[model samples]
Target: MPDSSAERPRRIVARREGPMLVEGPVEIVLEDGTTVSSDRFCVALCTCRRSRIFPWCDTSHRRHSPAARPAADH
Candidate 1:
C-alpha cells in the first residue's frame, strides 16, 4: 500500500517580478471575509497589482517593452 505521508507536498513559489505560484486546490479568505478558491494543479497569485482578476495571475506582470509594443504610425 502506498504511504499516505508520501503524497506530494504543497509548494509555493515566489518571484521578484511576477506572481507567486502555489500548489492548489487552495482557498483564500480576504480581509472582508470573502472566500475564493482555485482547484487548478497550480495557481498564480498576482503580485504586480495589475491583474483584472484580483489576487489571481492574469499574466499582467509581463513587461511592456518597446519591442513588444505595437508600432505607432508616422
Candidate 2:
C-alpha cells in the first residue's frame, strides 16, 4: 500500500468567478473510479461541469457561469 499523505501540498487557487487552479504535485480521482497521481505543475478544475474534460476545466466557464445561468437552461 502506498502512503497517500500530502507530501507536497498543492496550491488550490479558486477564482472568484471560475475554475480552481491547482498547482504542484497532486492525486486525481476520476468519476469512473480510476486514480492518477502526477507532479504536474498546474491543472484547472471545474467548479462547473461544463468542461469537455468533465472533472478538469478547459476554461468553459469563460463562456458561461453556472451560478449566473438559470437552472432551466442547464
Candidate 3:
C-alpha cells in the first residue's frame, strides 16, 4: 500500500515571455464571480493579456511578435 501523503507535489511555472504553467485539476473564480475549471494534466494560464480565451493560453502571446508573423503577399 502507498501512502497518500507521499504523493508528488503539484507544480506551477512562470515564464518570462509566455503563460504560467500549472498542474491541473484546478478551479478559478473570476472577477465576475464566475467559476472555471480544468482537468488537464497541465494547464497554461494566460499572461500576455491577449487571449481570446481569457484565463487560458491560446498562443496569443506569439501573435504579438513580428518575427512570428508571416510576410504579406504583395
Candidate 4:
C-alpha cells in the first residue's frame, strides 16, 4: 500500500494528452502580455492549445479524444 502522508503536493499537474491541472499559487501569462493569477487550490491548464481560456484548460481535449488525462513525461 502507498502511504498517503508520503504523497507530495503538486503545484501543477500537466497532462500528456489533455489539460494541465494547476494547483495554485499558479500564475498564467499569455503571449500578448496579459496574465491571469489564481489563488484557488486547483485549476486546469490547456495542453491542446485550443481552450478559449488560452493558458487555462477548459477540458477541450475531451472533444478531440477520449484519453483526456495528463501524463508524467514531456
| Model number with the top lDDT | 3
Please give the ranking of all candidate structures by lDDT, highest first, separated by commas. 3, 1, 2, 4
Number of colliding residue pairs in model 3: 0
- Candidate 4: residue pairs that collide: 15-70, 16-70, 16-71, 44-57, 45-57, 46-56, 46-57
lDDT of each: 0.82, 0.75, 0.86, 0.72
Error of 3 at 58 (Å): 0.2
Return whichever of 2 and 4 wins on lDDT: 2
Q: What is the TM-score ranking, best to worst?
A: 3, 1, 4, 2
Candidate 4: which stretches are off by over 4 Å? 1-10, 66-74
Off by over 4 Å in 2: 1-8, 66-74
What TM-score, computed on C-alpha atoms, does each candidate reach? 0.70, 0.63, 0.74, 0.64
- Clashing residue pairs, candidate 2? none
Better candidate number, 2 or 3, judged by lDDT? 3
Clashes of each: 0, 0, 0, 7
lDDT: worst 10-residue window of model 1: 60-69
lDDT of 4 by residue, 1-74 (tens): 23537867656665568877766666667789987887777878777888887777777778777555465596
Alpha-carbon lDDT of model 4: 0.72
lDDT score at residue 36, model 4, on the 0-100 scale: 84
Best by TM-score: 3
lDDT string, candidate 1, 9-61, tens digits? 77999877779999888888877999999888899998877889988988876
**TM-score for predicted model 1 compared with the true structure:** 0.70
